[model samples]
Target: MSLKITFSLTASLAVLLSCAAKKNQQAEADCPPKPCTMEFRTVGVVFTDSKGDTLQVKDFSVTLKATGKKLPSGAEQSTDAANPFYMIASDGDKSALSVEGDTVVVSGTHPSSGQVKKTDFVISGGRCECHINKVSGPEKIVF
Candidate 1:
């Protein structure tokens, strides 16, 4: 009887340990790693209706903003005074930009934009969204 009881207790202990380990693994899987930072830049060009063909206007401008803390020290930031566009570089993963038809849908990382990660950005004559990946660099906008 004692032998049987010991065996049963051992089996129960083993099952409990296995369940605990599984739960821990599940928790770990549910928690994802944090993201790094990157940088980006933007330039905007305007298209004007000159006679019949569309020409790029050199006097139009737009502004871009990010809902976060200021960029890191020594990080170069620039904007073209001739168009409506901007660039950002954060120590995070790939950022996103959304464009729908002739309008800019949205722009930013996942938590900020609340959009998909790898959606194709649409660019039109009116407005557009632009986001860069992990690197802070220059992006030219052609209207």
Candidate 2:
């Protein structure tokens, strides 16, 4: 290509990349300071036995990533890692949430399934997290 044509193409490419980078940075800017930490109580879990009976336990803990999100009201919310499907609430409950460890433990009620206790609580999948806004996954239920 001619020198002038080559220069024009290079400049155009640079601008396109810059624009794309800016857009990406803007999207991530909603995150609270890097490595932001928060705690959430009330994470739901399911432990079942072979007899179709849920395992009764005093506490349950699991690790998960938490990220920050921008609410429609211009507010900020914490989500599980890079996915917004799992939200971390501010209201501190019995649920023990650890950002550093990326783990959470929920306790209080004895383990029981909807069919076993006539309640609508069951964890069919191995493990999953769901947002409290009612964005529950087909494999998991986030109460």
Candidate 3:
């Protein structure tokens, strides 16, 4: 009877050990270790006005902003200035942009008339599009 009891106790211990080993293995497989060096990035913004005419950097001055849950108010991120720049807007697209929360504010002197223009645009994805329209004599972007 004593021998039989000892055998039963050993079997129970073996089962417990097996379960613990499997649990440890599963935990390791779930998430791997990172090198600890990584960076966050945003997407570039392309601009246009109500006329659907392409804007160059020379046409305007642009300031890009990036914000997350931490800073809902938003903060300045980067400024792109290139030749043929529509004042400072863009001839094409901008890169090195973060994919996280980002907003772009544009205000620049009209390349031709030197009139100042101000507007804000929130870029969501690959298509961070902006369209300016004159409503009640105030230029605004619709969506």
Candidate 4:
């Protein structure tokens, strides 16, 4: 009788372990291995005047507020005349950018007016979000 009881307990333990392993495997399968998007993504700030004219900004720079590390600028779309602006960050940067809340400063000089404008931005991105997200920032800056 004792032997039968021990066998039953052992079988139960094995079943439980098998179930737990299956559950873990399912959880791992639920998430895609490469969930991030391959398409190029970027966050840009557009500069405009009070007249609503799209103004080109010069001497544009993007810097991380905490470390004061300047990030690389994204490629400009020369063919995109409709939307001329400065890129703050891009997913192409990979590890350089993090998904965690990061404060970024974007500054540029108005070509004609020679006026410099600085904008604070909270941007985030990484494997999960894939594309960068602009948490807080003016999409268009009116001079």
Per lDDT, the best of the predicted structures is: 4
Stretches of candidate 2 exceeding 4 Å from the true structure: 35-143
**Span of 10 residues, lowest total lDDT, candidate 4:** 72-81
Question: The CA-based lDDT of model 3 is what?
Answer: 0.41
Write model 3 residue lDDT over 90-134, tens digit each, in one string. 212222233342456565444454556666554432223221111
* lDDT tens digits by residue: candidate 4, 87-108: 7888755445677868888887
Per-model TM values vs. the true structure: 0.23, 0.25, 0.27, 0.66
Model 1 lDDT, residue 4, Cα: 100
Q: Pairs clashing in candidate 4?
A: none
Candidate 3: which stretches are off by over 4 Å?
1-59, 65-100, 125-143
Q: Give lDDT per model, in order.
A: 0.33, 0.33, 0.41, 0.76
- Judging by TM-score, tell me the better candidate of 1 and 4: 4
Ranked candidates (TM-score, high to low): 4, 3, 2, 1
| Per-residue accuracy of model 1 over 52-127 as CA lDDT, tens digit each | 3333233222212332323222122235444323322221211222222212222222222233221122232111
Q: Residue 62 deviation, candidate 1, in Å? A: 54
